[model samples]
Target chain A: MPKRYVSIWFRYLATDLHSLCQPQLKSIPFVLRSPSHGRMLITSSNAIAESKGVCQGMVLADARAIIPELQVLDDRPDLKEKLLTKLAEWCICFSPIVAIDLPDGLLLDASGCTHLWGGDQNYVNDIGKKLHARGYDAKVVIADTIGVAWGTARFNRKYQVVSTNDHLSILQTLPPEALRLENETVERLHKLGLHKIQQIIKAPRASLRRRFGQDIITKLNRAIGTEIETIVPIMPVEPYQERLPCIEPIATRVGIEIVLEELLKTLCGRLTNEQLGLRTSILKCYRIDGKIEQVDIVTSRPSHNIKHLFQLFELKLQNIDPGLGIELFLLEAPRVEDHLPSQEKMWEGSVGLEDVRLAELLDRLGNKIGTQSIHRYLPDEHYWPERSVKLANSLQEKPIISWRVDEPRPVQLLHTPEPIEVTAPIPDYPPMLFIYKGKEHRIVHADGPERIEQEWWLQQGQHRDYYRVEDEEGNRYWLFRLGHYHDKSYKWFLHGFFA
Target chain B: MVVSKADIFKGLQTDLLRLQGLKSVNNCELNNFLGPIASAFPNHSFPLGVIHELISHRQEEVAATSGFVTVLLSMIMGASGTSIWISASRNVFPIALKAFGVDPDRFIFIDLKKEKDVVWAMDEALKCGAVSAVVGEIGEIDFKTSRRLQLGVEHSGVTGFIVRKASRNIGTIASVSRWKISSLPSEKSDRLPGIGFPKWKVELSKIRNGKPGTWDVKWFDGKFFPTHVPIDTLVASDQWHKKKTG
Candidate 1:
């Protein structure tokens, strides 16, 4: 016993398109026929047509002569292909793996899916009811082989299940035309009294091969599920789905929020089931008329938490203008990934609620003033005293640990070093009383000579001699003068104030 | 600028009320210094609720002033929260402040656009009441503006430090505690085999209710202990002075 290959063929006639295109054909006696075959291939009513002696492959002119009111229309291949694509999309409801069968069919590997719709018979009935409600006529057939299913769908019946052993007995009753053989082979078999598939199977293989070639017997054997036929379905495409089809178009902020909650619930549930989290979620609302309104939010980390995720969107919801009313709402996580939960005790302890609030405030401010307007200072890891900080935005992700400096620093640092016209004797001497802010104060007492050597590696290095000096009022200041040269002009800077 | 005898009595009363743990402008200040600086500076200690101006005419001035402020703040670094440094003009060198054990980890530097912005940010930081101190470098100051800031610090109770960089001379009218800092030649011999520690002279331009003059000081081995305040010794018998006092 050879291993079997089961192929289930799902055909959608696309009656919707047929009805739209052939609207005038309603209540009319119309027959779709092959131009070359000259027959009533598909008649609206065979009862009426049969009373007048009209049958398949009857000459159209003869059929028209028999029934003068007969209407013959040409087939549109483009329309049929478009309908097949839609049929493929509908089949995706059963499984993510559904591929289009060119012209008018879909090939689904419904092996594991039969139990989902409650067994094969119920699944077929359910699909049939759905299609019928949607104004489509659908047919499904399951067999051990692709060839048998193919032969069964067109040659068997509207509903079929050709089991392995019963395939031959069932196929034997089918006419030679049902084998889907080429015209030459069928004509050759017609001369041999092998009009029925059973008679063709009964004929001696050697004689059949001699007369009609091995392909006829081989095709016959494969069609009856004897020799296995494998089908390679077109690979399924990745889906980008986000749906919020509202029952009623919403127009107010409260209503929009309500709809948003429901949409987020459904979308988050789907993401959770798939074990995925969205990094970027875009909500596109289609207005009742035609225009589309969209809002997008990005999370610092991939997240699936419904409330936390909704909070981010709510902040942005204030900007959404609910113009007219939204008929369809789509929440799409265009970028998603598998979300793994990570505990954050370190950040929770180190960062205060004020820090989070400040970050949020900065984000809102940036949105209003433009993201480029807001800035934050980040410490630069360098030996240079003044050039140890860089500016960054609040939204930009950075390690919080780097924000802390490694060494002791000042309580107050000046914005700029003011040039003081000092009358100090030497390069290393602290300034006596230099004119500052245009007032003269005699240097009655002084302390310091903390020398900071130049960082020789950089071109902009400065040698500074810092001091802690007091004025007549007993005020203390942390000041420094540069050491660029022997008699370099002393630039006075108040770095910080003493307690 | 002149505090009357009645005002001194009032200040004493205020201090007494504050000592009783009453939350008032006078109560917010820390305990006075344990040494000579206690008499030299106003309020026995550096007042907390006041904007002290450290005016230096030259860049070398920051080192002189930073040395003193660093020594003063070394005791307060371990406390929670941070002291903010707002500098828009790139005057304060962070590493220079770091060398004095001011705990850069607890210091946050904010750079603003304009002088007015720096002042505005300082005012906001003062109101937040979380930071220990707020410091900024300003080039210009009027008497009225300084008075306004002094009132602000008094209300918020956080120390405010304004480093006013003067052009040619020390501006006497604007600051509560004004100092003139100048670099001094290292006291250690140049003939020494290695580079010696740097020394400086800090001129006390204004000391509220105390004498004002220059104090000779040396910052050696990264520490700033007063060097000129001589430890008087007994000439004949080293214990004679203590015996006399006893």
Candidate 2:
């Protein structure tokens, strides 16, 4: 049976965050050393460097003598792990099943998706091209077995393929070492006058299995295509997706609208069929050049209505450019879940109309203004005014309610409390006359000091005394002073105002 | 008889009951905020729906960030959800908000890189819906942008508070309400030179239905509770509401 496998290799430069983050040092000759700058662990990519007179496990002093220009970097496994994780996230665009082959490699199961971009060869070429364009030297090889592909991509490039019937013919031309056998085993084979893989192929299978153990022969046979290898492809996740392949390339707005209507119909059909709805749907204009432009619409609730979906698409599609004419349209439901349809008692009654209209309006406004420019607030458990509120996107779930200070609270809240010099009656009392924002204010009347303690777990926690004071003009303000300002001037701030 | 398209359609309808047989039910109005504020808003506490304008604003001052913080703190103390503050401004004062009864552990502050970052954080926070409200500082706001935010709030029913340092007269944008706040006077003590009982000249610049004018208010103790603030009155408390509090 035809099967698939992946080969992974890594290129690493030992350096702390500076060198690791710097794009220029990726190509430089470097070694990762321990914090003491002691022993150097030559990276896997240094095989070429080793052949050029460099050696692994060499002292820094000796290596410096061999290559005066060799750059030194501190090994940071933590940083490398972070970088690998980020790279894996970026790979989600290509394949869903991305496994970390660690220290710097990723194994992507691209078997099924190979046809999406033409074929396996083309897919590997595209991946290599993308990685190379991004300033990385990458190598890729695909074969029936993982062991063969791994060995071929790393060691023997020319003999990458081994046909089933021709495995004997191809196996003989390569050296016995190409099989990634132990150095001791190869040395023994050479002493036995078995320098070439063909010599081993001709040897009696019973003797080879008995001498080297059955594991060796089984691995060898698998690499030579005598046995089958299984590959696990990453399955596509169900994010609401809708596609419209146009009969003709659509360029005009009317043509786009027609396509959008048809696409909405399909999307709604899928939603109904799947018994699911979407809080958000991203409409993709898949151009012929394989470029995709997206416009996302958020709904208050999961909906499966064709007309409502069309209205949102209409607003979102207005800004999309059908450049060079759009041949295909794809709508992906990025967020979808099960939704219980509301049963209307009356046929003429508007069923979930308000929520739908609100969602459509939000979608329209999001398109017109900008997706990031607008936000709603959610509550966070923090006393700091700046950290108390959170930004929310409307597409997911609605926050239940806004935070309300039941007791007396400030009408105007300052982002940051600036220190004000005050000559108060006492250190604990509110300032009688204070200079704030370059202006001086006289205290006509005042209130109590609401003591708020800092969270000890935090590093810069402090104790504060907050007061709500009224000036002669009846303007309200929230003011506080940091406790225990021994040396520096006491820090006072105007926090908020009353409504 | 051989079935035509019309005959097939008729046959399909034989088992289908008329939709007219279904009885109509009244739409239940979505209840938004609870407690006294459940009725404070004309639309019942700004139901979790998108509004063109959130966090009513009348003036654009870099100093107004404190005002934004107070609104956020109030929501957190009174509402059912969590609170988060995404501050891209260098002027973020965490100490002051702590004094306003906001739970210190509940607040999460994310320092973003750019002005656009505040908006991005806001979008993510709004989508989470785990929090009750969000507050962010923006330099300027346009109609279309406010519309988008309003839609976002409406969709999730999360209230949003935007603090813009400067204003360029965005005439008649949609907002539940708008208010202009400035520092008033604080109380005095013989030992201290600074004021107490922070007062504010709060002008309701724009409200959905309420009057649009200025009201002299005081942040007494810690709340925005009504107080006898005689700012324009010629007489002091000796002649004014002193009769009541006294």
Candidate 3:
């Protein structure tokens, strides 16, 4: 069956955030500019601003020139993307497959979802009404092809639900830009007096190809129902899950063991065939007495070995309560990764990430503690000690950035720096004595202050001048003075304990 | 292989005491650890398939305990299998393990926020026979938790290390051995610009079938060497000292 695609466009997406967040900006004429950077072009304009001839890509200077009292605020692309992703996730209720169409639109695969709430037209009206009620201006359109839905949603005056068979006739009335061509291509087409899609469709394909390359023809075909275009669904159609139901409830350990073995055989076989391995698996036992118990095990590395996974479940078997006996067993893999093909060693036992023994051991350790408890860190290229390290993604991933041993780092770094009282005769020199948590320590061995400025662009924070100080009693402390000495806000803080 | 009743009686004395919980636990295997530290045991090796408890009362003592555990871990992880180190407070730096002759990558580090999770992870790590050993830095280990850990290692033929921080009860647990390690001021070469080899005073407070003793050892040139200081001379200093005096 031909896929039914729905495209919803937030016409004032960039400006809508300010309207939603500020509320007062809804009716006022406003434009978006860089919040912290030098003044520049206008990214977007509110409906009121647009009515007054202010539009996106207009120079901030020109917008100000047009409307002297117009308000211009930061156009936070990061915040906009975050909001767009959140909006797409919200639209998952309508259709399981929802993907953001770059800056402002959303694509939804609504093939079988039209009959759920109502018919296709009612579904569009329902979504549009709901979004408009939420202070958003949304234009909804449904077509057999993504290109038609995308184009009609933006250019059409009303909500359009074009049938797959008639998509070509309906799309031919729209402008050439609706074909998703670059501005220069659209303008070049307009220069040749080919203003509409019908003109392009009627024009010779060979001549169009010669003028604007093959982009226009391909896009035009995609906009209609003639050509196929694939849309990558954001979420998978189904999660990895397997279940076994028994007519008779199992109470004995041996019985449960048999069921578990059967489940593992199937799960592992499927995973192996797919070249996939699970990092986390959840086993649910549904008892005849309406009681449910679950036990989950996490692995440091992805694995599908039947015996190893069974052993992990075996450890958890005792914890599962067979209240009136369990009648159903459900196994689900929440986290899985591709088991990439590699050269296997002749020996049964191999070292490192690919080692089955290591993965089994780590799985047990991770299951008992919780996978989040395990961590490995790699050096990051930053002069600031705190920013110099990052959590390593996996055990196999080698650190591209090596540790900076030229400068000593503390063994134990405090989660937050603790302020300490420091006294010295010379302002620029290291502290002669520092009182930390009501205890005074006389510094015996001290290193020079290494000034590290905070990366202000990331986050604004005080600069630090670090000193490695060893107390008279052999206790080493990492102390840093905040900001420049001339500033009255300069203070000392203990950051870490050296090994 | 001669079955002498007298020799058996003498051997069973410690084994009987261990079985009754007076000592640590039963010795399931005769495989001793590597280096000079192993000679301090009765069979010239640390007992396998049991949990060894190490207590460090001071913050600096934790460093010594880390070094001591790293050295033993290298021996226990000889040739095969993986090791995991679980800690409640993440203080052990991975890069520092290289200095103690342990490849940081060979072990998995589990840092838990709650002390309970640390124990749970240790128990799980211990149960997996594929793992060679596990080291947990927790504040306390109850008698029941330790018993479960002992049973886990016994069934899997894995070794476990329990690093008890300050403020823990020095009461009895199911571990086969109890140790206390304190920094002994690393040896400094006369003409060197930096500090020399790491030195630690390792005290065996409790051993199942082995005698209890204290010895100062040095990790020099990637090996353990017993210092000239005799074991008995360091009798006043032990994990039990603070509790007994205070």
TM-score of each: 0.40, 0.45, 0.56
Q: Give fnat (model 2).
A: 0.13
The TM-score between candidate 2 and the true structure equals 0.45
Task: Put down candidate 2 lDDT per residue, A1-499, tens digits, no spaces.
Answer: 3555555454432232344468565556566555345445543324334545766556666777877777776655576667656666666666776655555566665546667878767767777777666545556665556656665566666643333454456555667676767777778878888877777877899999887777658767867767754544434355566677887777788988887777778788888888888777877787767777778778666788887677667766777887888888887777887877767645432212133443554454444445554444465576655665667544344445545454455534555566776767766677787777777767666666877777677647677788766556655456788775464545777766553
lDDT of 3 at A264: 81
Q: Scored by Cα lDDT, where does model 1 land?
A: 0.59
Error of 3 at A499 (Å): 3.7
Model 1 docking grade: incorrect
Best candidate according to DockQ: 3
**DockQ for each numbered candidate:** 0.07, 0.09, 0.21
User: How many clashing residue pairs are found in candidate 1?
Assistant: 92
Segments of candidate 2 deviating more than 4 angstroms = A1-38, A45-48, A55-62, A72-170, A182-194, A223-226, A229-242, A248-328, A332-499, B1-246
Task: Give the CA lDDT, 0 to 100, for residue B141 in model 1.
Answer: 62
lDDT of 1 by residue, A305-409 (tens): 777667667768877777878888888888888876555555433222134333333333333333443344556765444666655333333534354434333
Ten-residue stretch with the least lDDT total in model 1 chain B? B25-34
For residue B228, model 2's alpha carbon misses the true position, in angstroms, by 13
